[model samples]
Target: MSQKPTSSENIVNQKYDRCLADLLVKTGVGFSIGVVASVIAFRRRAWPVAFTTGIGSGIAWADCDRLFNPTRGPGVRIVSQAQTPESK
Candidate 1:
């Protein structure tokens, strides 16, 4: 009952995957930097600096949730009518 995706769908999926992967990689780097900055700030006992750094770190980590979501990534617009029930 199920059929293979058309060439366009395959291309769209590939593009989405690539975009998602890039977003995750970039977000991970940002989060790593934030963590390092927070650690350095806390170690120096700079309360104000540490607080700001920790806040930035939390924001960075929060953004990771979007990077993990499928519909959030940039890619082709798949029309509903073209999608099979299984694919949808």
Candidate 2:
């Protein structure tokens, strides 16, 4: 029989509170970088270039977010862990 996860694991899987904070911090760094680079590119009359730069940065930096929460990330899934129903 599979042992049930303690409150800690459920908390990790369900709420993703810690994971969110961690990702926000990690992603926020690169996000700032992206914003700055995008702004610079836009100032150079390269809107498409600026927009794509941020998208690329977001895709690349998103791995850090997956490192914290895999199954619950908005639309990105870099990890392959199976998501299970919350056991009562």
Candidate 3:
């Protein structure tokens, strides 16, 4: 017997799934582009494929990082409350 997943668990699972999907799509597209470039422009060199694939993976990683840590992303500001003299 197994219990149902909690809300937090579901959220985490969804995020993980999204990240995985992004990784696959981005990397696959990059690989395809790299193959074409290698064949047409790079004289069938292997580096273009590897380089483009790496770029795709890097993009996916940045997107995943933002999803997991929204506040830590670019242009996010954190504000702190000021204490009153009476409270202090």
Q: What is the lDDT of candidate 2?
A: 0.60
- Which of the predicted structures, 2 or 3, would earn the higher TM-score when compared with the native? 3
User: What is the TM-score of candidate 2?
Assistant: 0.33
Worst 10 residues of 2 by lDDT: 44-53
Q: How many Å off is the CA of 79 in candidate 1?
A: 28
Candidate 3 lDDT tens digits, 1-88: 9987679988999999999999999999999999999999999999999999999999999999999999998899877665434463
Clashing pairs in 3: none
**Candidate 1 structure quality by residue, lDDT tens digits, 11-84:** 76876676666556655666566566657755644454545555655655555545446566468355676575
Query: For candidate 1, which ten residues in a row score worst on lDDT?
Result: 44-53
Highest TM-score, which number? 3
Count of clashing residue pairs in every prediction: 0, 0, 0
What stretches of model 1 exceed 4 Å from their correct place? 1-6, 42-88
User: What C-alpha lDDT, on a 0 to 100 scale, does residue 85 get in candidate 3?
Assistant: 42
